[model samples]
Target: MTKVNVIGAGLAGCEAAWALARYGIGVRLFEMKPKKFSPAHKYGGFAELVCSNSLKAARLESAAGLLKTEMEMLGSLTVPCAKANSVEAGGALAVDRERFSDSVTEKIRNCELIEVIEQEVTELPEGVTIIATGPLTSGALAEEIRKLCGEGLSFYDAAAPIVTYESLDMEKVFFASRYDRGDADYINCPMDKEEYLAFYRALIGAERVQLKDFETHPFSVYEGCMPIEELASRGEDTMRFGPMKPVGITDKRTGRRPYAVVQLRRENREATLFNLVGFQTNLKFGEQKRVFSMIPGLENAEFMRFGVMHRNTFINSPVLLNADFSMREHPDIYFAGQMTGVEGYMESAASGIIAGTAAARRLLGLEPIQLPKDTMTGALCAYISDPFNDGKFQPMGANMGILPDIGERIKDKKEKYGVYARRAVDSLQRELDRIGCNSNS
Candidate 1:
């Protein structure tokens, strides 16, 4: 049997290994956990989610959901594991973090075709290999990756804080989606004009954690995950136009549009914990509690996790990788996960599925799978690998805007998204069948 090496045992690495094993290829799965750890990693398990547990929205019309559907069709291991361990967050798929990691770790360990190697991999191993070390990749291995990819790697990403559900004042917060488009999944903390101004003042005035001299780099915000405090400092109304925008939602109590709203998304299935949506921050812990409490419903919020910033490394894939995630310079070497610049959790796993399947097919002497661009996975692959974006490439998460616009101009957003979703599913299914890959398997 052909043997393939998979590095990092994170979400993308696990998916890559699982996909290879599914295709009857032997896998040497390497992990640096238990023996060594990244700054963000705590759980000694494969596929540990270091940040938010929620995998984003679960509806097909959403980009994250569409990418997940494609992963399932591609015989994904992480998506299934996540679904099995899911916690309730209204329309999104949030998992019990520990249990989710445990599930993936158990499956990988029990797979007969996989050999688990728990040690830090400082050097890239010989033979065909897949690197999925993710954004928090550290130490000597990250050095090796930097050498291979040149100067295209980055090292800073931020995550939002989580609060106990009991801490929120229900009277001040109401559950609702924008325009009631989906289920009432998000808890909205509505604010009047005066309240908005006061909260904004506090947020802008909060003390932020100072990075060490060596840690200081020109902070480039990934547009999608902009820190709340940073957004606030942009301008007085910058936040209102961004995450705290209150356009579609009407406060039930007043039956009027709130001047601003802070939305809390469920972080687990039990609905016991909720994270402030789009509230990623780098404020000092005490300052976070002091300033964040200024929001209407969170005056006494019991914070479970305070927002923190960390370095997230990624390669400039557009110049180095093929659409299938194989290195253009060395076809035998593949990269997956956030390291490949596919930003979201499921997007990383989806890339792993592609890279693993592609690697397996090459080892088996089969033709490469050319995914249709209409599919969410295909669009992401195209986005990351297109050399046109070489100089301007930033980490991209799954979003409908990345997909090709529908030929007909449909004014209704939901209907247009529905069409895009249906088209992607059909296209992906056809391609999978043509390649003799069983989506259900």
Candidate 2:
């Protein structure tokens, strides 16, 4: 059996190696964990969940949900592990961070066909390979990657602040998830109109660390993970409608919905630490302490970790790779994950599935699966490789707009998304059946 090399055991790399191994191919899965760690990584485990733990919405009508469905259909490793180790998080698929990574790491290690290499890979290896080193590809490997894919584009991704649950004022903040769909799993910090306005003002004016010290390329902000303060600079009401939107639950004390809300989601299975949902920021340490403390229930909160930003790099995929995520100039080489311009965590994993499966098929002398354009997985693949976006490629997440439209105008947004999901899944199933390579089979 032919052996393949897969670098970085993050979500994407793990999925890629799993795909190849499951398909009866031997794999060398390289991870720089216990030996070395990235700025965002704390655990020496595969598929570490950093930034945030929530895998977005779990409803099929949502883009993230639809994307995960497609990934599972194609035999995803991470999605199933995520569901197994999932924690209560209302409508979203959230997980206990350490447990999730530990599960993935255990699975990868136990796979007989996958040989786990514990050192860093400095250069692109010969033969078939998949590079999923992610947005924070280290300096030496990143330079090696640039030797083929240009200098690439970079931006900053921020992580939300977490506080010890014991430090929160339970009297002021009540537990309830959005829309009350499931059991109350989130800690809600309700704010009146005056409190919201005051906090918004402070957030926008907070001092931030200068980006000049960190960036070598021109500054470009990825909209999906835009720093909370930067998002606030867009408009005062942005955060109100975005992360702080007070649409679902009524305050237990007032018996009426507050003007805005700051939600704290459980960060670990123990429920001792919670992170502010959608509060990723780059404010200076003191500024973060000052401004974020203004939230009604967080006045005396003890900060476990302050929100911090780190530089991220992604290749201009359209200019360098094919739809299957293999380099056009170097067909034997493949790229997956956020570095391939597929933005969210699941999206990155989906790319790995594509790259690994496609590589597996190629080695087995089977034709590559050019997934139907209507599927969320296919749309993301297309978005990253379409030549029309050559010089101006930007990272994209799974969304209905990227998928070819349903072709009928439906005034109801929910109904429209429902139709989109159904169409996509049906199309994807037919394609996978014809290919003879789905997880269920």
Candidate 3:
């Protein structure tokens, strides 16, 4: 049996391990927790969801949601754990952090094909390996990765908070999707002009957590999701136009469009957990609760996870990695997770799944598989590995825009997404068949 070592038991690492284990590959998994822990991860469990518990939208029209659906099609353990441990806010899958991690860790540990090592890796081992160390990679191995990846390695990533569903005061909040396009999954806190202005003032005044001098980098926001505080600083109405926009939503009580609306969506399947929509921030925990709670329905809100801004590290994938996430300098090693310049939780795991699958096949004298370019998975890979010599490469999350446009463009945004989803599924199925992966199984 071939031996495969996976560095870092994060979302990506665990996913990679799971994928490889399913392929009958023996895996040596490294986890630096319990022995040593990062600033965010407190528990010693595998696949710990340290940031927010909520996976994004469940709709195929939504990119992250589509990615989750794709992961399910590809046989992801994380998605099923999320579904099993879910607490319903509405449609989005949110999990109890403790249960989710525990379940994943248990499953991985019980697998006879996997051997978990409770220490940090000082260097990349010889033979087939996957580096899914995630964004907050430790200094030692990170240096090794930097050596192989060259100047593309970087530090500085931020995240937002997640709220428990039961803690919210739904009496003061209304349930409805934007423009009523979907069901009532979003918990909306309607704001009058005065209330909106007041929230804006407080948000601006909220104290920001300072970063270390070494961690300072230029402020580059991920276009898919921008931090709430950054949005506020852009302009007063930025929030209204961005996350807090009230265009499609009306206050059910008044039957009028709110001046601005703060939306919270279900984080899990059970409808017992909720997360603030577009509320990722760098505010201090106390400040986040203090100011965010001032929203009408959240006066007594209890946050399951507080908004956080931490240093997220990654390499310039386009310059350093092949479409399979192998460093150009070292083909024996592969990269995965946020470290690959693919943002968001699902995107990271999906990358790991593919990388693990590819690595397993390669060790067995099989050619590496590339997802079809028409699929989001393939599109993300192509984007990061674009051959253009120009230095500009943006970290991307799953989005329809990244996928090849269909020949017949549908004017309706939802309909257009449906076509893209169908094409992606079809394209993915062909790749799966070629790789002997059965979606039904």
Identify the leading candidate in terms of TM-score: 1
> Which model, 2 or 3, shows the larger lDDT?
2
lDDT of each residue in 1-441, candidate 1, tens digit only: 668999989889999999999988999999988999876788998888876899999999877888888889889999889999999899999999999999999999999999999888989999999999887676688889888878867565677887867668999899999999989999999999999999889988888887543334545557777889888888999999998999899998899999999999875444656788889898998999898998888998877567766566789888899999999998999999999978778988889999999999998888779899889899889889887667655576776766666778776667987999999999988887887778554
Worst 10 residues of 3 by lDDT: 387-396
Colliding residue pairs in candidate 1:
87-269, 88-269, 155-311, 155-312, 156-312
lDDT of 3 by residue, 1-441 (tens): 668999999889998998888878999999888899876778879888866898877887766777887788887989888889988868787889899999999999999999999998989888889999887678898898788777888654554566655457768798888778968878899999999899999999999887654344454556655678888988989888888889998898898999999988664334544668778777888999899988988887756566555567778877788898887877888989988878778888899888887787777777667688878888778767775522534355676656665777465768877888888888888888887776444
The regions of model 3 sitting more than 4 angstroms off are: 156-310
lDDT of each: 0.86, 0.85, 0.80
lDDT of 2 by residue, 179-243 (tens): 88898999999999999899999998889977643452444556776789988999989998899
Best by lDDT: 1
RMSD of model 2 against the true structure: 12.9
Better of 1 and 3 by lDDT: 1
